[model samples]
Target: MSENELIERIKDRNPNEPEFLQAVEEVISSVSKVLKKHPEYHQLRILERMAEPERLISFRVNWLDDEGNVQVNRGFRVQMNSALGPYKGGLRFHPSVNQSILKFLAFEQIFKNALTGLPLGGGKGGSDFNPKGKSDNEIMRFCQAFMSELFRHIGHFTDVPAGDIGVGSREIGYMFGAYKKLQNDFTGVLTGKGPKWGGSAIRPEATGYGLVYFAENMLKSVDKEIKGKSCIVSGAGNVAQFTLEKLIQLGAKPVTVSDSGGFIYDEDGIDEEKLEHIKHIKNVSRGRISEYTEKYSNAEYTEVNSDDDFNPLWQTKAECVFPCATQNEINEKDAKHLTDNKIILLAEGANMPCTAEAIDVLQESKVLYSPGKASNAGGVGVSGLEMTQNRMGVYWTREEVDEKLKGIMKRIHDDCLETVETYELSDHNYMEAANIHGFLKVAEAMKAQGVV
Candidate 1:
């Protein structure tokens, strides 16, 4: 089938889903060259099912606040294709939760899980209610209400949900409590549980650690390494902190970590003391990152807003860049600045951090740009680990789990390089390699299963 014909068929089937359509189009474009080797996929047109999900679940989450006032929020779970394994992904509970965002995440999870060589499918669930200012009791009540419905759709062997964004250990604990209450069972239906409740020890840091592992693998593809290189990482959340920790362990200096308000630049280097303080402030105390400056003079925190100048970090050259924050955080301007400084490697710790234009700029400059799916699969990959431990009624040691995760990420990195070589693409075309590698697996699965 021609590329235009495949896109038209996808649009005709999923017209209302603009985000889903765009994701499908991008994957098709990346793998169109490789599709010639597999004429069976074109004959079956498995790309159509790849465009639409098997099921989309939308429901209402009604609960009571601390004042006994009723609050209502919309909850969603898009169970994207599960051809490879059971449904697996994180549950993001932010005000930005919607059908479009969940669709894109779930769609991406399908391929992310596939790349891991795990027996897990793709699914994402979340609510639109923000847990920022809510009291503990209020958050518990809301989670209970949300899980009242979600528990019926998820299970240990079927679908497993982990923490994402606003959802953390507290939220996961509450949701798990509610699920146990509803199902009257103690199975590990959800991941990221408290250790006392069957959670993995290093689950929180898996994504960041996996990202660095993938980065190291990508660096090795060019006969280079991350040791002694300076890394600029955004987001002070789980991904950022762990990425910093791993970089520090590997003898790399990470000088930046950001939040929604702004970012901090520490030219002197981010030590363990500073990292511990940031974790306490953001995770335990739930405070802003601007307070980091109050503790250390060398570390300056500035609000990343329209008027704020971004030159401090951008102008300071770095060998590697990891955007662990939200999507679209780095645009064309940011990409140009990094490329101009001779930044050799770029990997996304968050989903789709680099915009399409920014990615284009990176490829033009021949920077090793690894997409989030391949770079940040550690989170979901470890989530799958949690599921495995749960099913076997056995938990692996932190070292054991981390070893498996590193191996998986290394394989993914090598696979990306092998894919580029097979397709005769450029050295820096990580996106194409990742997209095609992930697409071919799911596409072949869809073909074997036949059109639904």
Candidate 2:
């Protein structure tokens, strides 16, 4: 059967899994070229096996609320692939978490992990448990309940889960504590641990920093530099915060950051002092983005208008933009606005932040677009470092980890370009290059391991 037929079968087998289907179609389209050139891959039926997960575990998380009410949330872990190494990925906690979302994330993780050139596989677990407005005790109890089942499936040398979205260091600590207590062993089964524990130094900042570093490379490919360029960034969470921090350090003028409520635009750029305020508001106080204007009168905060077809944040004039918020944040309309404003580079910090149509717009407009799988692997790459640190029983300093991360991101950027050259594909879209490169490695590994 043809590659397109495989996609249809996938959709039929996993109905209501649009996110997972989207991810599968994107990568399969890239590898389809290889299948057409070398039909052996088709004869071996690699796509059929690669599209399915090794295992999908779903469980019910039961906990008690502060008021003694029984609360339950559905949790899932989709161990998509382990051809390279143990299952390595993050666990998100949000109301939007579902099997489709986790499957897409895990599928993307497979390619993302492959691009990192690290001995890591792909998996993703999360629940529809929203941590918003939950008391500390309640959150801890909920996490303990979630880990009670998750702990059985994960280990240091098996599947190592990290924090994502609503799952932060706090959630990691709670889950780790529960895992330790239940298993009666303290192991590095989880990443994003507090610094006092086994967490690596630069893991929190890695995704954001890595996004900038890769974007910088993309810029250099065209003889451009970011030293004095204006950047518009979306999201004020962990990824967006550190992205702004690194942009400031690199002498770029990043002027915007957003949250669910809306976004803030600061003409003077987000300085160190202003970034500290943002960190405090986001990481500590958990306030809305509009609060940014309260402290700095010069900055402007625009509340989100749900009726609009696009976010005004992308309509701003800038040379570069980072969509660090969530999936599908940049739709086709947003992409057109970006091209109209001459935003040259877009590197995703969040998984699948750009819709397929949006990507078509950016690539057609000559924007240096990089997919999250290739660009945001820094987070998982550092988690691999944390796993190494755990096995070695020694932790590296912040500077040491930062240098290694920069090197890894550089290699990924170079490898993507090299693979594009080898495949002779139109790299106006870097996703095709990254997807093909990542697919080749994992497909070979799976082929080597046989028809298991």
Candidate 3:
């Protein structure tokens, strides 16, 4: 079928799912030329199956709050494409949970997992249940209720879920405990388990570290280097903190870190002592970014009031930018600022943090732009590694897992380069390159396995 025909078919099948359709259309546009090279896939009707997920599971999660009142939230798991291996992705637990967002994430995971060269398929499950302000018992009860149904559809060799957004180690523990009770087995059904359990040592830092590793490859392609470059990173959570740490170790100087409330700028760079304080406060104490400024007089924390500009911290000049925050954090205006400041590298640590308009602006200016699918695949890549260790019943040391993650990131970089060269595209547009590279792998697997 023609491109237009395929798109029309997709629209007819899922008329209201614009979010999922947008992602599918973008991937199709990037590799349409290559698909023309192989008419067999088209003859086999691959696009029909590729456009929709193989399975989508939705259910209700009911729990009792500390007030002895019943609370309910909707849950979902979109097992997109699993021809490569078992379905694997994170489970997010936030108020914003819905079919549109989960479909976008699960669609992205299909390519991200393939890029890791791990035998993991793509899937994502989460609930609209908000854990914030809930007591420990309340959160545990919600997780158990969510997993009671989810456990039936998942397994170690079938589907393995990690954590994302509001779903942290604590939530994973609750879900895993419930799964064990339902299945009556102690299996590695999830990847982001605590170290005391079957979780890998490097899973926490993999995404952030992998991002810098991918960026390093982008730098090398242009005969540039990461050493001594200034970086402005958004988000102080797991992905941001680890990306900053890895960038510093690789000789990049990160000077800014932000949270939901505001960002803190440290001209002297964030030292270990300061990072420890930030982590202790954010992770352990659950305090706001303002506390960091209170303890350290030199650091400046800007209040991100609703009326304030979205990216108040972008006024500062920097050579590199890493937006590790939520979706659409970097707008078109912010893209212009980075370009005006002569930012050489802009790598996304969060999924689609750059709006389509912002991305177009960056592409027009010719700055090296690495999308999150490839740059932030490190977290899921490490989860795949954890699955491997679990299957083998052998846990690796932190250093060993980090080494493997570095290797995978290097390979992802090389794959992007190869795709760019093959298409005669510019090196800066690694987004298209990564998308095509990831797509072809899953496509080939689907072709080999036949339609499910």
| Candidate 1 weakest lDDT stretch, 10 residues | 306-315
The residue pairs that clash in candidate 2, if any, are none
Model 2 C-alpha lDDT per residue in residues 252-359, reported as the tens digit of each score: 999999998899899998999999999999889988888989999999988888688898988889999899999989989999999998888999999999998998
lDDT of 2: 0.91
- Cα lDDT tens digits, model 1, 19-112, are 5565666678888787888887777866666767788889999999988899999998888888887789889989977887788789888888
Q: State TM-scores per candidate.
A: 0.95, 0.98, 0.95
Pairs with steric clashes in candidate 1: 85-121, 86-121, 262-304
> What's model 2's TM-score?
0.98
Candidate 3: TM-score? 0.95
lDDT head-to-head 1 vs 3, winner? 3
What is the per-residue lDDT of model 3 for residues 1-452, given as tens digits with 9 covering 90 to 100? 88888888887877777567766776777778667888877887776676678899999888888888988899999998898899999999888788877887888899999999999899988999887777789989999999989999999889999999888889989999999999999999988899888889978888899999888988988999999999999988889888888887887788898888888988888777778888888888777877888888888888777564447777668999999988778878878888889998899999878877788889988999988889999999999888888889999999899899989999998888888888877755788998888988988988888756
Ordered from best to worst lDDT, the candidate numbers read 2, 3, 1
Considering lDDT, which of the candidate structures 1 and 2 is the better prediction for this target? 2
Clash totals for all models, in order? 3, 0, 0
- Against the reference, the lDDT scores of all candidates come to 0.86, 0.91, 0.86
Report the CA-based lDDT of candidate 3 relative to the real structure: 0.86
- Maximum-TM-score candidate: 2
